[model samples]
Target: MGKNDFLTPKAIANRIKAKGLQKLRWYCQMCQKQCRDENGFKCHCMSESHQRQMEVFGQNPNRIIDGYSEEFEQNFLELMKRSHRFSRVAATVVYNEFINDRHHVHMNSTQWATLTEFVKYLGRTGKCKVEETPKGWFITYIDRDSETLFKERQKNKRIKADLAEEEKQEREIRKQIERAEQLLPPEQNRESEVEDSAARELKLESGVKVGFALGNSAKLASKEKTEAAKLVFEEPESDRGMKRKADGGGSKSALEELMREEEKKKEKINRKDYWLCEGIVVKVMSKALAEKGYYKQKGVVRKVIEKYVGEIEMLDSKHVLRIDQQELETVIPQIGSLVRIVNGAYRGSNARLLAVDTDKFCAKVQIEKGVYDGRVLKAVEYEDICKIVQ
Candidate 1:
C-alpha cells in the first residue's frame, strides 16, 4: 500500500505494534536489529548483511556481550538516578518503566539474566539501599556526588567538635567549683551567721545605728551593700529629705551618711548616661582612669550589641553596659531593694545575683544559707524573689 494509504487507523496501529519490542528470540545483539516475527528474523539472518555481522561476532562473541553489558548498566543507572533519585521504589516497577522506551538496552543482550540479578549487583556495589519485602525488592538511590559527600562530612565534624568543646568546658568548670568547695572550712560555710555577727560588732563599736538590729536583717543589709558595690555606679539626684536630716544636725556621722548617699546616686546616673549611640563620642572609662588620669580619649560608638549582657564598641574597644531596663533607667523596684526567695523548697532564703534569665523570668542566685548554703547558683523564679540585688 502507498504511504498515504498506510496512514489509516488499522495500519497505524499495526506499525506502532511492530515498532514495540517483540519476542527476545527475534532480536539479534550482533546485528543490532530487531525483527517483528520469526519469519522475518529467519529471513534477515540469511541475508548477506546479517551473515557479515554474524562472522564479526563469531571472531569476538564475548567482547560484543561485554560492550552490551556495560552499555545496559550505564543506561539503567542513568535512568534510575535521573527519574528516581530520592524515591524508594520496587525493582520490578523500575524495570517496567525502563522498558517503556522502544530502543532501550534489552536484558537478554546484557550479562545479567534478569532484573533481579541486576538489582542485587547494584546493592552489592553500594549504589542503592536494597531491602526485600514479600512483594518484591525495593531500591533507594544513594547519591554519589563527591562535593555533596564532602560537605556533609564537614558539617558532621563541626557539630561533633562543638559538642566536645562544650563538654570539656563544663568539666573544667565543675572541677574548679569542687576544688573551691573543698578548700573552705566547714565553719566558714555558715555565711548568714558570719555576716550578722561580724557586721553587728563593727556597727556597735563604730557607734553606728542602722534601721534594723535583727541578725537576719543585718545579714541582708550587708549583702545588699556588697551587691551595690559590684553594680555599675550611677549617681542619683541628691535627696531633699537627706539634706533636711543633715540640716537638723542629725549627727557628724549622719552628715557623712548623707554625702555617701548623694555620691551613690550620682554614680548610678552617670553610668546610665553612657548608653551607646553611633557617631556619639565616648570617653575611656577604665582602670586607666586612676593611673593615667582621665583624658578626653574620645571615640565614636561603632555598634551596640546584646549578649547575655549588653555591650558597646567605641573605636576598637568593647565595654559591658547595663542591659536591664530598670537598671538602665534607674527605676526603683516596687518589691523593695532586698533579694529574698519567698517560695519553693528554699523559701525565706537570700542570695546574691549572678545573672538574670529575663526570658525565663528567673534569677541565678548564690545561696547564702539553708541546705544549699555555699552553693553559687540556684535558679529561682523572678516572682518568688523580692528583687535582684545586682
Candidate 2:
C-alpha cells in the first residue's frame, strides 16, 4: 500500500501501536499517568484537555522544559536524600533507583550531560558531598530537611545526656558505698590503735569501768628498749674497714681496669671524623686509603676533598681531614637561594630563600605576587622542601 493508503483502519492502528511506549516504558510526572497500550495514549493525546495542555507548552517551550528539569532534579534529590543520605553510593545506583518511577523525568532533559557532571554540580551547589577517586565518583546526599536533622540531633543529645546522668549516678552510688564501708566497725578497728585507745579512755571517763593490763604494757616497753640498745651496739667500727678491704681485692681491681679499657674502646668506636649534614653524605678518607690493606697509602683524594671543605693532614699512616667549623655554615643555602615548597597547605609556591634560622628551626622564604612582592613563609622540616633550584 501507498503512504496515504496506510492511513486506513488496520495500518493506522498498527503504526500507532508501534510508535507508542510499552507498558513498562510509560511515565507520568505530574498527574503521574502511565498508559499500558497505544490506543489509550492516542485517545488521551486527541482529547480536548491534552490539546489545551499542548497549546500551553507550545506557547513557551523553554519554560516547560525548565519546569520538567526542575521537577526531575527535585524528585531525584528527594529519593537520594531519603534513601542514601550520608552514605557514599555509586551514581548509577541512585540513577537506577530514580528511573524505577514511571513518569520520572529523564536525565537527558536535564542540564547535566552525565552523572559525574550532576554529582559535581551537587557538590558545587552544596546539595551533596561528591568525591572523585580512581575507581569512580562517589556521592553522599546532603539532607537539608530541618525537622528530620533536628530530630536526629535531639536524639543524639538525649542519649548523651542519659549516659552522663547514668555515669554520675554510678559515681554517686560508688561514693555512698565507699562511705558506708569506711563507717563499718571492722574497718574502723583496723584504722589505728590510738583511735581505739582514745575511744576506750572516753568510755572510761564516762563512768564505764574498763580494766587495763599494765603487766603486758610494761613487757612491750622493755622489749622495745632492749631491741633499740642491740641495734646501737651491734655495728662495730673495725669490721667496716676490714669489709672494705675484702671487697677491694686483686680480681676486683683487675675487673675495674678492664671496665675502664672497655669504656675507652666504646669511646673510640663512637668517635667519627666525618659527619653527615642535611642532604649531604659523609665519606671517610680512611675508607679511600684502605684500598691496599696494610700498605698504608698516604695522599688525600683531591676529587673527594673538593666536595668538602677541610684541611687534609697525613698523620701516622692515616690521612686525617680536619673539617673547618666555617664549612658547616658555608655548605648551607644562603639567602636568595631558589627553592620550591613541596608539602603542606601552601604547596607549589616557589620562592627565594630569605634566611635560615637554625635556632628557630625554620627557613624564611619570600614569594613574589604580581607587583606587591610581600608574601613570606616559614618552612620547618625536610618534608617541606622540594629541591634547591640552584
**Residue 68 alpha-carbon offset, candidate 1, angstroms:** 2.0
Residue pairs in candidate 2 whose N, alpha carbon or C atoms collide under 3 angstroms:
27-103, 28-103
Query: Relative to the true structure, how large is the alpha-carbon lDDT of every model?
Result: 0.55, 0.50
The 10-residue segment with the lowest total lDDT in model 2: 199-208
Judged by lDDT against the true structure, how good is candidate 1?
0.55
> For residues 192-250, could you state the per-residue lDDT of candidate 1 as single tens digits?
35566452211222233322223356456566545432211112234334544656633
lDDT by residue for model 2 (103-143), tens: 56766556666777777666545566566566787777766
* Candidate 2 steric clashes: 2
lDDT at residue 42 of model 1 (Cα atoms): 91
Which runs of model 1 end up more than 4 angstroms from their true locations? 1-16, 170-174, 177-390
TM-score list, all predictions: 0.42, 0.31
C-alpha lDDT (0 to 100) for residue 23 of candidate 2: 56
